[model samples]
Target: MSDADAAVGAEVDVDLDFGDDGLVPAVAQDAETGEVLMLAYATREALSRSLETGRAHYYSRSRDELWEKGATSGHTQELREVRVDCDGDALLYLVDQSGGACHTGYRSCFYRRADGSVVGDQVFDPDDVY
Candidate 1:
């Protein structure tokens, strides 16, 4: 790590920002392509791991553990930048993605049919991804 980045990482206080549920919103965007890929949540360890490893990591509230996005599915988000909102309750992740960001074989999780009411079109079955 560069000296500047190491300094910033060391000073980041992740515990100061988590919500009551111990979660902070993490917005993932494509670093090179500039597309928003998905949104998730990160707990303290997840945030720390992301900073240390330069990979997108998050907390799965349902599973109650730190998870690296796409870890099992062979798609990964390589962290480019992580920014906190003014309130520190939310985070923006700039990443370089490998493979589809969504388990459904799409580049982003935001893929959905826009009928008048916002319908979803499932492109790939969940069984195929996990």
Candidate 2:
């Protein structure tokens, strides 16, 4: 392993409190702008992979597998740092994001308010990308 990988591996050794399903909620935020990008679940393996690879990895509940963000859409996230919540049950991933973070072409998953207002910019068309 490279020095960077070793350092990440050491960092991933922290004990996290995974839920009964062996998963924890992970929130991804733009490191520079502090924009909340997306929220996903993570397995221990997924967390390790994110740290080891310096990229975002998430456990897809619908797909029932682990996935690297932007593996297909090309909107990848470069992980800057990870912060654990006080309860150790959640994680915050500070990342440098490229392209829209939302699959629907929005910059963030929380593009709409409870009233359903179209507020966030549509960076790309999903019909063309997906």
Return the top candidate by lDDT: 2
Local accuracy of candidate 2 as per-residue lDDT tens digits, 18-106? 98998999999998889999999999989989988888899999999999999999999888888889888999988888899999999
Give a tens-digit lDDT track for model 1, residues 9-42: 5347553578678888999998877878888899
For model 1, the superposed segments whose C-alpha errors exceed 4 Å read 1-16, 113-128
Steric collisions counted per model: 0, 0
TM-score of each: 0.79, 0.91
Worst 10 residues of 2 by lDDT: 1-10
